[model samples]
Target: MTRNKLRLAIIGAGPAGIYAADILLKSERHFDVSIDLFDHLPAPYGLVRYGVAPDHPRIKGIITALREVLDRGDIRIFGNVRFGEDLTLDDLKRHYNAVIFATGAVRDASLNIPGIDLEGSYGAADFVSWYDGHPDYPREWPLEAQSVAVIGNGNVALDVSRILAKHPEDLLPTEIPANVYEGLQRSPVTDVHVFGRRGPTSVKFTPLELRELGELRDVDMIVHDEDFDYDDAARAAVAGNKQVLVIDKVLQQWRQREVGSASRRLHLHFFAKPVEVVGDEHGQVAAFRWERTAPDGEGGVVGTGEIREIPVQALYRAVGYYGSPLPGIPFDKRLGVIPNHEGQVLIRDKESGKSRQMYGVYCTGWIKRGPVGLIGHTKSDAMETIKHVINDLGNWWRPESPSEESVVELLESRGIRWTDLDGWHRLDEHEQALGAAEERARIKVVPRDEMVSISRGEV
Candidate 1:
């Protein structure tokens, strides 16, 4: 009387999905369990490929460790397969004993501002996707502007600001597609502004990322004195940190240099909320109308009667990423998460008790939780979800008929060539080769056409 091995399909090849697979594959009790991981991109490593800034090769190296887990005999990698688009939730439930939706949030939260729909206004996701060489984005980008306004204070904003500040020779090393790389080299934009509604303490950027702003030998980092007026708690966040102290020292240096410089500038502005985006006659953003804000004593911004006008030709709303509705899963639109207790997927009617009607349907990462936390934080969140999944394995192993389809078979039948560990190795080599050709670290293939051709057989 041996227990049945669980059949699992983890949709999403991001950090959460990869970590979940890693843990499950390593667990002795789950030796018999099999996993088929799916991702929309031809290449694996979701955010690692698309979200992280191109220049940060060290952060992208996490893929090497993930590649180890993927090499395990029981785990399969299915790239270039979209979950909801190619296969339905019900379709997945019909095949595997359990399905884990680790699909990371894909879309950005829209700013519903008056002129946000203008041609020059873009979301941070698009901005990132463009520069990072996401296959879906076009190779040509709009870089012929003088000033750009990015509305967020997160690491992403920092990344965008850093790239904008990079000298062309420095940028030549990363895998930016030829056209984007050329466009950036010819970029007319010299000033970048990252705006936040709150003070520096409430900013989503970690201290490490903030310090990178000072690394630019050619770019000036400017912080208005007015923006640093934090209240007690907010002040405490910066008082004792070595990184914060470094940031303070860097800003002090930047202040001394801000008076007159011809170099590109990365300006961090706080306590200002965009009330409206002013657009030119051609429907491109020309400037921004912002209202002054002060701390309301309870970790929020309160509007002041003061107003400020800043000239801008480009804008990106990097407020945050949001989750989209998945079929058959209960979604909480307000919270941007699927309804669940701990890590257990909760049914609308069965909220009072744990229900296992659907055998292997589960969720992890941003889709299960919400788009929050850094990559390291995803490990703990994934572990909690795996615990619930392992506990619920009993119900899926009953004496009834077994699932007929698994993610691997469906992908194979559809002619989707998912890269195994060896295949990814080849891609890694190819990317490095391309990088060498450009005399840069690694040049990314940004166009979807090129990514598809390379993944398929054209390259």
Candidate 2:
């Protein structure tokens, strides 16, 4: 008796989704297994390719590991395939034994301030996408600001501030697209203000990210002298937690440095809670208003009722990233995640007043949990989801067409111009070729049609 093939479909070709596919294939199994990774874009590695900063090749190294998994011939990738639009829940149920929604968050979490809608105000996620050469975003960014405000203390805020303040010529060594390079080159930005709502010891920045701010050539690191007023709890955190200790040490070193007249300045402002974005007569961002905050004895901070405003032509809200809801999935709009219990997708049952697992459905990554934790933490998250997935194999979907050929036929029938693993290889080689000619690492292809055309050998 021959064992049956276990077919799986994963939405989102980001790190989380790629990890899930890799783990499942490597795991001990009772039957033969196969996976098909899907993404809306023609390329794979969703956020890793599109969300990361261009200058930080260190963080982007995760893609090499992800590439190894995709290179394996056992797994197939269907690119430029949108889940809800190209293939629905019904379509997935007809083909695969399991479906995992690993659609990580991309949209910026709402700031809900008085002047957040001003012309010069933007979401850091969008800026990241623009600079990373995402095909979907506009080619040109309005980098017309002289002074900018970044409202977050996380790694993302740091990335934005660094990119805005750093000389455009410095980014040329990386994979920065020509259009993005041109935009930054013309930017008149001199001061970049990074605001954290908590005290010095309570920032969300990693040790490496914080230290990198000071390393930017010709950019001065500015930390307000008063923001260092650490409370008893904050002081204890610095003495105890290893990460917090390193972060505090970096800030202290910056505070002691004598001020120099650098062409650009990157300011680190702690104990500042964003109150509003003040708009100018033309409804563009004129200034940023924030209230001073104090440590509230615990790990959190309380507003000090001291409002201050800074002159800034632009603002970026990097508070958080939120997930987009799928057509059939039950999403918690407030939390920006799918309702899941340890990776099993759940739906609220009106009669029982509780959530029950939606059979044959699961989730992992930022879509399952909120947008928190580092990329390394994603493997553990995938492991949790995979455990339930393997144990509950008996509960897998009974598909009408489980053969791999059926999915191809369905896609062709719908006229979906889906690119396979081979297509990704073509696109990858093309990017490298383009980069080699420019004497750089890799210049990313930005237009959607151009990427798809290259992948399909139509160009």
| Candidate 1 lDDT over residue span 162-249, tens digit each | 8777776676667666776787888887888888888666777776787777777677777788766668766665686666655555
lDDT of each structure? 0.75, 0.91
Stretches of candidate 1 off by over 4 Å are: 28-31, 229-231, 240-246, 297-299, 350-359, 397-409, 447-453, 456-459
lDDT of 2 by residue, 1-459 (tens): 123677889999999999998888888877778798899999999888898899889888999998888887878999999999999999998898889999999999999989999999999999999999999899989998899999999999999999999999999989999999999999999999999998888888899988988999999999888877777898899889999999889988998887777999998888889999999899989999999988889989888899999999999999999999999999999999999999999999989889988988999999999999877778889988988888887788889888889999999999998888888899899988889998988999999988888888887
lDDT score for candidate 1 against the true structure: 0.75
Pairs in clash, predicted candidate 2: none
TM-score (all chains, Cα) for each model:
0.90, 0.97
For this target, which candidate reaches the highest TM-score against the unseen true structure?
2
- Native-referenced Cα lDDT, model 2: 0.91
Worst 10 residues of 2 by lDDT: 1-10
